[model samples]
Target: MEKISNFLEQSRMKDYILKTKLGESSLSTVWKAEHRTTGEAVALKQIPVAKLTRHLKNCLECEITFLSSVNHPNIIRLLNFFECEGCIILVMEFCAGGNLASYIRRRGRVQECMAKRFMQQLGAGLKVLKQNHVIHRDLKPENILLSCSECNPILKIADFGLSRILLPDESAETVCGSPLYMAPEILQFQRYDEKVDMWSVGAILFELLNGYPPFHGRTSVQLLQNIKESTSLPFSHLVLPELHPECMDLCSRLLSINPDDRLSFEDFYQHNFLRT
Candidate 1:
């Protein structure tokens, strides 16, 4: 506790002034803050120490450890972190345009050109994560944010609490992630590698074009069953008719039931859909 107090004192000297509460979840609360000296805005995530279970503690440590070593334009940057008596504070790069989930909710489906641009940026970020041997277990619209509210805003990937650093031959079997965007392998409790993230990318791309997930169910059991039994994307004719055939093809490949058949990040970037 004494060490925590000292750390808080030192952090206060750095002059981060909290402005407004940005968002909150069961484990943490995020705030929009600014550096008093430089006036640079940042997102501050506060995780209460008292409420952390063993699993949550591990997640917190994993997120901080991995984020500190990564530096990429399309990935959210963790600038600083502090541990206080009651909570852990992480100062992260602020994205004024907010997350993709809200952006989609407001505009419904995004235009093809804009969706392509965002997908390209997201793919770039995933490439970096792959090079670093990290797998983002949870990849969804809510985990993606815009750098600014503009016609061609830079898309940044955020939320690494469920991420894991894998070895050359390692695969994760943890059935953890948002059910809506989870890969079929993950939902079926099968061993999955970084390819799971690609499946999620497909789900996001589908939602960006259609305003809803490819698979849906009234209950978790039903959702899992739907994902396991699903063989193809149930594309709406109204939306599909307007989108390029190449785009639809790419989505289908990415969301393939078999992980081995799913498009690799490199292939996705080079796909005709993105090229067009």
Candidate 2:
């Protein structure tokens, strides 16, 4: 709470009281705060406008614009935002269950039914992105949040730092996203379409089912090489017999190195893995 009082006191945004630091990066800090009148919990992300790079500023604008326009249970909501001094603050809903990464870390490999439910929710969120012509260049377990610690919690997609709008036929040439979850086309510096997001979803699904990422490397080149060489998903023997065939099929399709063959968001959302 004391960490953010100076900033809050300086601004007109004195209606909220910062309680704890949620996260921090070189460019911004996130704090969990409570509204003074309503006692509602919220996440406040503070970024210094003076220190923002061109790319970061663009990402901030995109995040604000995209979040403000859409409303979905699987997508993080923007409560309010205000600028003060040299900083830009974004107010968002506070997710109590932390992120999917922490969820997976604590539980290890999840049950088949649970993994399927997660994928379905992620797909539902992607539908919103597709409708808005947006590409969430960064999609990983760390960016996906849980609404609660209940037996069945809602998954909300968060962090639009690397997102951008891309039309149906358009492709993005940017080389960004986490190495482990990034598509081979992106790592190879090839222009890619929305299918790149599917690759990320595949990596998330792989981690959920097997408790590890599909590929690992010291560098991007090595990772690309690993993906190129692997003829099929390297499922652990322990789970090989336990996992459903449809689940494995969907995961393999999403991880396809060739974007041309990768499942589109439409096909992915309606995949048999989710249907069954």
Best candidate, TM-score-wise? 2
Off by over 4 Å in 1: 1-14, 228-231
Model 1: clashing residue pairs?
none
TM-score computed on alpha carbons, candidate 1: 0.92
Worst ten in a row by lDDT for model 1:
7-16
The list of candidate 2 runs beyond 4 A from truth reads 1-11
TM-score of each: 0.92, 0.94
Q: lDDT tens digits, residues 1-276, model 1?
A: 977778765766357888999899887889999999899999989888988877667777778888898888899999988865477889899999999998999898888888888888998898888888888888999989889887777899998878878777898777778989998788777898888899999999999998888998787779878876876678777787788889888999999888889998779888988876
Provide backbone clash counts, one per model: 0, 0
